[model samples]
Target: MRAWRFHEPGNIANLVLEEVDTPPLNIGEALVRLECAALNPADRYLVQGQYPRAGAPPFTPGRDGAGTVVEVGPDSRFTPGDKVCLLGGGLTGVSLPGTLAEYAPLPEAWLAPIPDAWTFEQAATTLTSLTAWRALEICGGLQSNDTVLVTGASGGVGVAAVFLAKALGARIVALSRSAEKRKNLIALGADAAIDTESSTLEKEVRAAAGDQPISLVIENLGGPYLEKSVRMVAPEGRIMVIGLLADLTATVTIGLLIHKNIRIQGMSVNNFKAKEAQDAWTKIVDLYNANHHRPPISQVFPFAQVQEAFAHLQAGPMGKVLVRCSA
Candidate 1:
C-alpha cells in the first residue's frame, strides 16, 4: 500500500509517500479501504511534531476518514463492504498507518455507519461536525432560544456549530474575519454575522443578542477573544473552548469572571470519554440521516495532491477541505 508517513516531523515536507506493508486486523477491528480522509489543524500540529502523541519516525498521520469495510475480524459486527466512518482509534496519520493510505485497520467500536445520502466526502468530515455538535449540545448545555456566539465561524467545526445551533433553535451570532465568509454563515442559519476585523466583537455580539449576554460561546480562538468572551458571557453562561487558533496565552480579568459567574470550559473532541463519544456519534448520525444539517466542503483534493489541500487549509478557507482517497 502507498502511504504518506511522517519520517521526522518538522514541516509538511516531511510527509513522504512510500509503499508500506499493510497490517493485519486485530480482534475487534476491521480493515477499511479508505475512500476519503479529512484533514484538520491537528494534522498540521502532528506534522510539525507539536502534538503530544509521542511516536518514533515513520508513522501515518490522518485522524478521521470514511471508507468501506474490505475485511472484518471475526469478533467485529461489521462485515466486508459495509460503509463506515472511523473515530478515536489513534489510527490517524500521526499515530498508526492512518486513512491516508488505501487501507486502514480500525477498531469496531470506533466505526459508525454512514448515511446513504451522505457522500464519502461528507462522511470523511464527520469527525469535525461531531466535535462541534458535542461541544455545543453536550458540554455547552445549549438550549432552544439560547443566544450563542461562534468564533472562527468559517472553519470546519465553526460551520458545523452554526448549523447545529440553528437546528436547535438557538439565536446564533457568527464572527469571522472575512465579509464573504460572514455571508455564508448567515446562509447557514446564523441570526447575525459580525466582521471581527472592523467592529468591536463584544459590542457587536451584545447588540446582536439585543443587549442580552451570550448564553453560550463556541470559542475556537483563544487570545484577546478569550478575554472578551469571558466578559461578554451572561451569568452562569457556558463558554466552550474547542480550539486555540490564536495565541494560547492571554491575560484575563478575574474580576469579570467572578462578577459574571461564567463557566469557561475547554473541550477537545478527541478527549471525550467513550460513552460521551458514543452519544455524540449517535446524535451526529441522526442529524446527518435526517438531513437536519450538512457540513460545507470548501474543496476536495485527490490523494496525490494532499499537500495542496493542507496548504489551502492553512491559508484559511470558508469550510472543510477533504482529500478524496478513492475514485
Candidate 2:
C-alpha cells in the first residue's frame, strides 16, 4: 500500500508518499479499503509540529475517512463489504498508522456503518459532525429555546453546528470574517451572522443577540474569540471550547466568569470513550437520516495531490476538504 509519512515534523513539505506494508488487522479491528479521507486542521498542525506526535515517526497523519470493510477480526459486528465511515479512531494518525493510506485497519468501535445510500464523501463527514454534535448536545446541553452562537462559523465543525442547530430548532448567531461566508451561514439557517474582523466584538455579538440572549457559544477560535464569548454570553450561558483555530491560550475575564455563572467546558473528540463516541455517532446518523441536515463538502482532491489538499485547507476552505483515497 502507498501512504504519506513524515520522518521529523516540520511542515507539509516533510510529507512523503511511498510504498509501505499494509497494517495488520488485529483483534477487534477491521481492514478497510478506503474510498475517501477527510483532511482537518489537526492533520495540518501535526505536519507542522503544532499538534502532538503521539508516538515515534514515521508519522501517518489522518483521521476521518470513508471506506469498505474487507476483513474483520474474530466476532466483529461488521462484515465484509460493509460500507463504513471512519471516525479516524480518535487519534489514529498520530498514535498509529491512519486512514490516508488506501488500506487501514480501524477498531470496530470507531467504524460506523454508513447510512443507506449515502455517498462516501458524505460519510467522510462523520468525524467533524460528531465533534460538533458532542460539543453542542452533550457538553452544552443545548435547548431549542436557546439562541446559539457559533464562532468560526465557516469551518467544518462550525458548518455542521449550523445545520444541526437549525435542525434542532435553535436560533443561531454565526460569526465569520468573510461576508460571503456569512451569507452562506444565513442561508444554512443561522438567524444572524456577525463579522469576526470587527474591532467591536462585544458590541457586534450583543447586537446579534438582540432580545434573546446567546444561551450557548460554540467557540472554535480559542484566544480572542473565546474572550469575546465570555463577555457576551447571557448569564448562566454555556460555552463549549472545541477548536483552537486561533492560538490556544486565552485570557478570559475572571469577573465575568464568577458573576454570570457561566459554564465553559473544553471538548475534544480524541478523548471520547467508546460509548460516548458510539452514542454521538448514532445521534449524527439519525439527524442526517431525517433528510434535513447534510454535511457540506467544499473540495475533493485526488490522492496524488495530497500536498495540494493540505495547502488548500491551510489557505482556509469554507467547508470539508476531501482526499479521494481509491486508486
Candidate 3:
C-alpha cells in the first residue's frame, strides 16, 4: 500500500507518498479500502505540527473518509465489502494511521454505514457536519424555537451548524468575516448573515433574533467573538466553543456569567464517547437524507497530487476539498 508520511512534521508540502505495509487489523476493527477522503484545515496543521492533538511524525494525517470494508477482525459487526465511512477524529491519523491511505484499519465503532441517499463523495465530505451535530445539537441541546448563532459561519463546522440548526427548526444567525461568504450562508438557512468583524455585531444579532433570544451559540474561536458572545447570549443560554482559529486565550467578563447564568463549554469532535458519536453520525445521515446538501466541493485531487491537495486546503477554499484515493 502507498501512504502519505511525514518524517519531521514541519511542512505539509514535505509529506512523502511512499509504499508501506497495510496496518494489521485488531479485534473490533475493519480494514477499509478507501474510495475517497475529505481534507480539513486540521489535516494540514497536523502535518505542519500546529495542531495540539496531532500525533508524532511518521504517521498519515486524515480524519474523515468513506470506503468499503475489505476485511474485518474478530468481534466486528462488519464483514467483507461493507460500505463504511468515518465521522469523528481521535485515533485515526493521530494515534493510528488515518484514512488518507488506500487502506486503513479502523475500529468498527468509529465507522458508520453510509446512507443510501449519499454517494461516496457525499459521505466522505461529512466530517464537519458530524462535528456540528455534536457541537450544536447534542452539546448545546438546540431547540426549534431557539435562535442559534454560529461564529466563523463560512468555515466547515460553522456552515454545517447553520444548515443543521435550520433543518432542526431553529432560526440561525451566521457570522463570517467575508461579505461574499455571508451571502452563501443565508442560502444555507441562516436567518441573517452578519460580518463577524462588524462593530455593531451584537446589535445586528439582536435584530436578527427578533422576539427570540440567542439560546445557543457555536463560537468558532476565543478571540474578539468571546467577549461579544457573553453579552449577546440570552440568560441561561449555552455557549459551546468548538474552534480556536485565533489566539488560544481571550478575556471574558465574569460578571456576565454570574448574572446571566451562561454556560460555556469547550469540546472537540475527537472527545465524544462511542455511544454519542454513533448517535451523532446516525442523526447526520438522517439530516442529509432530508436536504442532501453535502458541503460544497471546491476540488477533488487524485492521490498522486496529495501535496497539491494540502495547498488547496490552506488556500482557504469556500467549501470542502477532497482526495480520491482509489480508481
Whole-model lDDT per candidate: 0.81, 0.85, 0.83
Off by over 4 Å in 1: 88-94
Error of 3 at 178 (Å): 2.5
Which prediction has more favorable lDDT, 2 or 3? Answer: 2
What TM-scores do the predictions have?
A: 0.94, 0.95, 0.91
Candidate 3 all-Cα RMSD: 2.1
- For every candidate structure, what is the RMSD over all alpha carbons to the true structure, in angstroms? 1.8, 1.5, 2.1
1-327: candidate 2 lDDT, tens digit per residue:
998888887878898888899989888899999999999888877877887646467877788889999999889999999999877537677686777889988888888888786899988977778888888887889899999999988988899998888888899999888889999999988889988888887787788778999999999899877888998899999999988888879899899999999999998877777777878877777887795566888799999899999888777678798999998
Q: Which consecutive 10 residues in model 1 have the weakest lDDT in total?
A: 88-97
Best TM-score goes to which candidate? 2
Report the lDDT tens digits of candidate 3 across residue range 1-327. Answer: 988888887767768998999988888789999999888877877877887767777888888889999998777788888898886554787667887899998878888888886777778876788788888777888889899999878777877788889889999988887778888888878889998888888999998888998989999866867888999999999999987776668889999999999999997887777777778777876776778666666678999988888777655555677899996
Candidate 3 residue pairs in backbone clash: none
Candidate 3 has its poorest 10 consecutive residues by lDDT at 312-321
Per-residue CA lDDT of model 1 for 103-162, tens digit only, reads 888777777887668778888886777788878887888889689999998998899888
How far off is residue 144 in model 3, in Å? Answer: 1.1
